[model samples]
Target: MLQKRICIIDDDPIYKLITKKLIQKTKLYSETIEFNNGNEAIIYFEATSDLPDILLLDIEMPEMDGWEFLDEFCKLEKRINKESTVYIASSSIAIEDKLKAKEYKCVKEFLSKPINLDKLQKIAEQN
Candidate 1:
């Protein structure tokens, strides 16, 4: 079984499918859990005993956006452990958004759409 568990929070079904396939291709993560929105993801985290090793978050969604999630996530003292990490996976090109993400300590990087093998490799190497 794959050892690493990764969580993806995004609204687009097509994007989630493609991302899951790409991550599987890398053989990096053992488990991939997806949420259509940040609220759902938060609920999962609250209910589960173990959190994913990494979180791929999107800035836009119907229920809860990335920014709102991060704000609420930070307040969840029991949610994240030091072993876990978060990344902003967004199609947004706005410099302000990127800068805003950097403000979050758990966020490692801001990734643009069409995340490639090279980027995935780099993310894998971070841990």
Candidate 2:
């Protein structure tokens, strides 16, 4: 299996912990990084030369929401790695949110929250 670096950008610590555990269980990622919000992730992206191969983002956050992150990411897209894949992993079931996600070309998929191990495995396989 190809071991990739995965980044989880969510405000909920519990969610982050659980997701991290699940990601580890998949055994497909070399490293897992967590960010409290989109802003922190953006800062990391700006500073780090080693960017994540996969990004799991939450729509609702304190510092900067997922949508805001997408916007900022778009601006920094040129500087960042084009191979990086972004997935919007939010609890939101709103159709509007899903539609909004489609507007961003960087987003590979809009996944519902509480992503299971199977989903993680599939994501890893696809990428």
For all candidates, the clash counts are 0, 0
Clashing pairs in 2: none
Error of model 2, residue 71, in angstroms: 0.7
lDDT of each: 0.84, 0.91
Error of 2 at 7 (Å): 0.4
Tell me each candidate's TM-score.
Answer: 0.91, 0.95
lDDT of 2 by residue, 18-111 (tens): 9999999988999999999999988988887556889999999997999999999877777665557899999999999999999998899999
Candidate number with greatest TM-score: 2
Error of 2 at 74 (Å): 1.9
Residue 123 deviation, candidate 1, in Å? 1.0
Q: In candidate 1, what are the lDDT values of residues 15-107, reduced to their tens digit?
A: 999989888988987889999999998888777746788888999999899999988787663445544688899999999999999999888
Estimate candidate 1's alpha-carbon lDDT, on a 0 to 1 scale. 0.84
